[model samples]
Target: MTTHLTGSRDEWLAARIELLKAEKELTRLNDDLARRRRQLPWVRIDKEFRFETDEGSASLADLFRGRSQLLVYHFMFGPDYKAGCPSCSAIADGFNGIAVHLANHDVSLTAVSRAPLAKLQAYRQRMGWTFPWASSSDSSFSFDFNVSFTEQQQREGSIEYNFAREPAFEWRSGKEGDGASARASFAAMTGTDMQTYTRDRPGMSAFAIEDGVVYHTYSTYSRGVDGIWSMYPWLDRAPKGRNEPSGPWWRRHDEYGRG
Candidate 1:
């Protein structure tokens, strides 16, 4: 009844041993990449960026919270949305548990969104999340970081993200399983249209402080953030390896099993 390959124990062990060699090589390569990321030149942040946090108005340096390292997850929750993006929410589900560990390691982890503080606070409470979240509602912090875009930029096909210019409207009509419909579905779940929903994208930025000066250290967007998705690493080691034929079957943790 099954068409999957079957092999003797010896054969399977031989194949697994070969795969282990490749995995070790990949692990070494990843280590080198991490080292390179740390060695990259840091860009000084001279412009002032502000945020609304539970503690009231805060500046970029304040985000470090006495730690030298600051990591901000650019959560996708634009002002127009009634809720946060499901994908961003999924990624954030892992944040609360990791925040304490990171803080102990001298890294402050926070989520930044373009939504107002009230909306973010309500949603954070609903999700039962304790991780620090800040609103960039009254600041150009999101735009400066290239995670939020303007209407004019979208109209003129000038939206640049992930170190590349995104096409204006082509992705909207892309075939199913290519992420177009999935994005639209996520937008609807967030009580927004695709355009408004996509105006804000997901990213994470790393910053460092030295001598009272703040500097941008690194950033990653789109698929580059896969390493931190929490579930994907486990899924990758599963028998079926992500197992999705229909693209993104995940929902916000609370939304699961309701349908």
Candidate 2:
């Protein structure tokens, strides 16, 4: 009854061996890329960046929690949004499990957002996550990292993210199921209009502290973050291989059966 390719066990093994060769090459290339990422020069961070955390107001250094390295996931929960981006939420679902291991390896991984600490805490509790989440609401930390943008920047097309300039968000009254409509639906899920919802973007940043000085080491955005998306690797191996014919057909984990 199946329309997929049917083959003898030996035939399948031969094809799988070919795929394994390519997979090995890719793994080696990724190792080389990681070495280059480490070789990238670190920029000293001199400005005072503060954050509100469960412990209280803390400096950027405080985020390291005695570790020499810090990894910040720029979560897209702007001050106006009633909820975090569903995409970011999906990515964050894996955080709690990894935090302890990363900490043991001399790295502190935290999620930073522009939402108020209280709001973030409420959302975190709702999601049953215990990983450290901090608020950059009263600081320029998110803006400095290029994850948060202003209304003026959005209007002027001056938003530079993922290491390139983005054109201003053009408003389109798209028909249902169009790109614009899909974006609008995501915005509504966050309880904001399209423009306001989009001002905050998602990315990750890395930092290092050496002898009392903090330095910005690396950052990545957009598809560059696919490596850290927990579900992607499994999906890549699935028979259907992500199976997203329409694009981004995922919801927050808990919302799967409600609709």
Candidate 3:
């Protein structure tokens, strides 16, 4: 008979102390990262942009909609694109649930896209989304925010890429075998999928509204998705992962089944 001796009190205490130390380190790192984020330099946006809302056409100021802050998710539905980006769609789905909480925080969140009002509305309906989405079809808003490209610029092939809105990722791989000892690896991909569109920029623009005027506060993209749905670990598994089907509650858009 073999009797394995359990760890003594001192060893258990030492292990717990180590865990506490690791936790403290994690907390410090998080605080430092947040402080660095706050220290990011700000750029002044002195231009006026336009958008079309359900009420009517309005300037960037109008997006505030009587709120103190405006957070706009630069959705990846270009004016000429047939559909919205799948990743952007995923983000929108999550936004539908948090719009109310944002309102409580005095921050108005909206999704903005380069598509025309009618087209955007159609897609929004297909997705069953109720969150506010506006159209920047007629304005240089998208181009200014590095989310759009002009036809002439595309033709010239000298268009400046919007690094601010591009997605980035890291990939790794390994081989596996008994005799060969295969290695395995993983990759982390970020940013929006802008390949379908002629232009490849997608980002979020945040504005602060004061006294009936809107001021561009901050804008971010690529890893910005990390702040939204990606923050929820379980969300990564929806649709194909662990999410259960809605049965009859789900309906396919008429347009989707045609093809």
List the pairs of residues colliding in candidate 2.
none
- lDDT value, candidate 1, whole model: 0.90
**Predicted candidate 2 versus true structure: per-residue lDDT over 65-164, tens digit per residue:** 9999999999989999999998899999999999999999999999999999999999999899999999999999999988889999988999888787
Error of 2 at 97 (Å): 0.7
Question: What ranges in model 2 sit over 4 Å off?
Answer: 170-178
**lDDT for each residue of candidate 1 in 98-184, tens digit (9 for 90 to 100):** 999999999999999999999999999999999999999999999999999988888889988888886784332233244777778
The residue-by-residue lDDT of candidate 3 on 51-101, one tens digit each, is 899888887777766778888898878766666765566667778778899
**Model 1 misplaced regions, further than 4 Å:** 170-177
Minimal lDDT window, size 10, model 3: 180-189
lDDT at residue 117 of model 2 (Cα atoms)? 98
Model 1 TM-score (2 dp): 0.96
Per-residue error (Å), model 2, residue 258: 0.4
